[model samples]
Target: MAYTIDRHPGPDAPRLGAMVLHPIAESVPRARRWFQKFIAPYNPACSVDDCALMISELVTNAIVYGRSDDPWVVRVEWFREGASLRVEVHNPGFPASVRVRRPDANDAHGRGLLLVDSIADSWHSGPSPFGGTVVSFVMADAWPS
Candidate 1:
């Protein structure tokens, strides 16, 4: 598992921040803080709390479901788009499925995507260009007064 946060911003990825994290439970909060700070200056309207919660869910899923044999590297990224903020979480292993389905209340697992679906303005999961799954979500930008 690698522990590196690379900073690279570009026209294509305006206000972008990316990091490669070990697929561990602690990586979830680390990603949340990094993403919150990354989008703060650019997307002032972003709800830091919402970003925190959603980021946690995404990274948690990656850590819990990613490949175990290989060092599972989770890539987290965010960028400003038009009037929205986009966040993507990538993991090294693909899941059997990444669809949102309601789990029974008694069920202690499988609520990550459901949480993301309710919080994010829009989101989708699919094969990443690099190999594995990429879960992404967009939220409407709210500028501060």
Candidate 2:
């Protein structure tokens, strides 16, 4: 999907960075990369790899469940707020109805939200200003590592 990457810098820290891409499988990896670089400066406090994994899951969900036959876009953005790191994924679809559920022992799928729940300090979903579902998650600025 055609896309654009825009990075905004703040004197104290990275302000807001965003990417808009067509909802597709490849967008998942791209999202992860953008997220990693966006948070690179703060990796001393944040877990970049964990954040990237969450990005992958959210982007995958958007591509797999949030799109239709009509062309639409998925957006990713991240920024720092005090001692918190916030990430959001917005896609073209109805508001997300996300919930955490137990996965079967042998199940290979259906664990996206669960992973988010366990990893993120807090998370939620709602309608996006850009005309679709938005799922946002936040993690503490300082991780155990």
Candidate 3:
């Protein structure tokens, strides 16, 4: 229910780049570009578009709930192991444990993670020692050179 939000260093990256996206509305466009460029060289299946959407939804969550004064962070890193691409969207904190439910007719909010859940081939959320929760998604693809 109550989760802390903080930035803690994560696993060693073996890919293009890892960025810390500030939890600000103005930062979304720049954040999407970061993901596009990262997958430009490899061009994996359903990768570029999917990754962008993933970033948008995850970062949007950080911006929405991280509270303007709370200083939220979106830590994103990509790595390929065997036959999968692992994309982790690290949030400073996790809200109360709530299942992803379809919104009612008048609902406009609460669909961010819903998008993440539907689009991402696989995803999960867990506690972060850094003080929050990191929601991760993985798309299966061959290793790139």
TM-score of each: 0.85, 0.83, 0.77
Better of 1 and 2 by TM-score: 1
* Candidate 3: RMSD to truth: 5.9
Model 2 gets an lDDT of 0.77
lDDT of 1 by residue, 1-145 (tens): 3343555566665646777888778788888877777666664576778877988998998887777476658898877776777888888667456778789989998888898898889998888876888999988764432
Per-residue lDDT of 106 in model 1? 98
Candidate 2 ranges beyond 4 A from true positions:
1-14, 42-44, 142-145
lDDT of 1 at 21: 88
TM-score (C-alpha, index-matched) for candidate 1: 0.85
Model 2, 89: alpha-carbon shift in Å? 0.4
lDDT of model number 1: 0.78
CA RMSD for every model?
A: 2.7, 3.4, 5.9
For candidate 2, the per-residue lDDT at 131 reads 76
lDDT of model 2, residue 142? 53
Backbone collisions counted per model: 1, 0, 2
Report residue 93 deviation for candidate 2 (angstroms). Answer: 2.3
**Residues 71-135, candidate 2, lDDT per residue (tens digit)?**
78888887666677788888876774566769998998889989999999999899888877999
Ranked by TM-score from best down, the candidates are 1, 2, 3
Better of 2 and 3 by lDDT: 2
